[model samples]
Target: MSTNFTYFADMSRKGIFSGHIQAMVYDRSKPFNSLPLLPPTGIEEDVDILKKLVSSSRALASVDGKVQRLPNPSMLVNTISLQEAKASSEIENIFTTEDELYKAVSDTIQEGQASPSTKEVLRYRESLWEGYRRIQEKGTIDLDGIVAIFSKIKNTSGGIRPPHSLTVIRRGQSEFRAGEIIYTPPRGPGIVEHLMANLLDYLSDKVDPNTDPLLKMCISHYQFEAIHPFPDGNGRSGRILNLLYLVNKGLLNHPILYLSKYIIVHKDDYYHHLAGVTQAGKWKPWILYILDAVEQTAKLTNQLITNILEQMESTLEHGRETIKWYTKEINELLFSQPYLKPKLVGDRLKIASRTTLNKYFSELQAAGMLAQIKDGREVFYINRDLVKILEG
Candidate 1:
């Protein structure tokens, strides 16, 4: 294969070295160009619309430092729209429910539960939920809390966090090398200094304290990823930075922006826009994409929350009629923990025997609020209506 090389000044007059890579200066005035930068195609354009809606949905979900409640209706609609696109997409191994994705992201951040394999997804959900809660209470974002999210998503496949090295592979090659480095950044010296300093400046200057915090977050995300300074963890760190930036701007009481869901769904486009900006200095397309994502995500999220409420209300009405004794208790239990085990019901309601808990759950199932997923020793109950509400 043909090789492409870049060289820097030698180590005598003024030079530095770190890692196994070497660098050199290139003519800055030369026209730097890459492959043809094209706008989204027809199918991609359609998907892009959904991506925008989901992005908006996520922004609206922010707690805004405990000053705002749940996202407004527009936000819910966008969230649901994005979810629909995700479910309809032909991508393999994609999560079908908003709950599954949200739970995965939230749990990871809040509990610090590391996935030995992709376990971080569960914690992702937990952490995200708590992030929203924090917004409600504190009315600010939390950077450190957001950064702890990646430990949970099990690195199953598809390179969750690729090392900061130029990747090279022909059409059919399976293996690759890491140390074939090039493209030295404009920093005088030190990697973290160049990236971190700019980030801190943007956070202080460009970010408007009052204008929609989520919008500011999208800007911060673009700036961080463009720098791509870290040798590793840049992707994950950039993402985490989104949540923290929101917190810093006081747009959310909790750092619960559902960005990854949209990004993961539109993974190809996300990369495409980022590359377009770096290669061609094209910012409009990326900015539009980010704005669109925030708008839609927020709308869809709000709708899901509404759907959940409706489902809960319907279940409560049924419980009042059939399961009279523990109707309120069971309803509260479902609201608190949508994923319920028989033992959990028994424990929460103070029921003595497994038999009684089973009876209560059976009553809920009969009333059409809950459904059972059973296979040998593992028996789980889902609020089917609630699931339906969220996906819708």
Candidate 2:
């Protein structure tokens, strides 16, 4: 059925933002088919498309350890690379429900999300941990593990898998239609489940595990998203799948390259490219996008790591006089985890005394090499200057 789509506006009179529109679907039996309530004029520039390309390219280049001039001479290549990075990172960073959701995801993925939080937090934590475990033990992809992991996130226990009736709304102010699928995931009763098992086997064994890791990752990501196997948490599942896929393929030593940031920023384009392939028989854009994200994220992540190392080196060099071996050791440790406690310091550095660890931490803080977090209990030592550089 044909649907009319329009945009919305904010209080400030700014045009309806992309990804922020309300859509109503009229049944074919009714007089109207659909109407997309849209906002007014969006921000425009003489060089909007190019400007977007520029921003995306700059972001992409920045991720890959290169900070290009704001407006570059090589518009064509930059635009291409920007699209690539934008596609990949969008897939990498799936948005959570809120700040709590973000922390839950961050903690679950980076650390472990085990403390008291929402049901979503618990599920995300369990799912992420399960993915990590599968990577560690089998170095193989496991659909059942993924299903079970998401089952926990959905707060359903004693089920073979999540039910297909679950619904989700991806767009703001847009409700789901009866026939339209906001997020109707696949059912794993028998036929669908069997297909999934086979798909995983093919992904695991289609090629020699030791070869063309990046290409393997791309193929696996496409295959998993196509399968759309779970009733809930598919987006999160897909993201985790990408990282674990890389780890199993040995592309990344750890799940540190959270490409989600890139994706989250270019979320609209990301879904567009994915839908383009599904609806318009397009694949190159998606593939190139994935490749660009990988290359850019890897380079950007590597740069972050390098910057952290360099900052550590410089800090240690400058503070060598006042700081002890424990100080340097703690600095390196903090670089690895970004957040730590005095207990972790004592345990990691083999400092038998908490007082000694605290002493070292205090001296480092005084030296402006470390800072505490919002949490009162945890005083996280940070390389402020390096942190700023990475954040920028």
Number of clashes in every candidate structure?
A: 86, 14
lDDT of 2 by residue, 120-161 (tens): 444554565567677788767776677666576566653334
Report the lDDT tens digits of candidate 1 across residue range 1-392: 01111222232113232111122233322211111111112222345544664555455654232224433433332333234333322122333444444333222242243222233333333333444455556554433333333332222222222334432211212224434222223232333333344455446553233434444455567656545444333455566556556555655444445555666668678867865555544555676777776556555445555565566577778788776774655675665544457766677667788777778778878877777866355566776665555544
Model 1: ten consecutive residues of lowest lDDT: 31-40
Compare the candidates by lDDT and give the number of the best one.
2
Q: Each model's TM-score?
A: 0.60, 0.61
lDDT score at residue 89, model 1, on the 0-100 scale: 28
lDDT of 1: 0.47
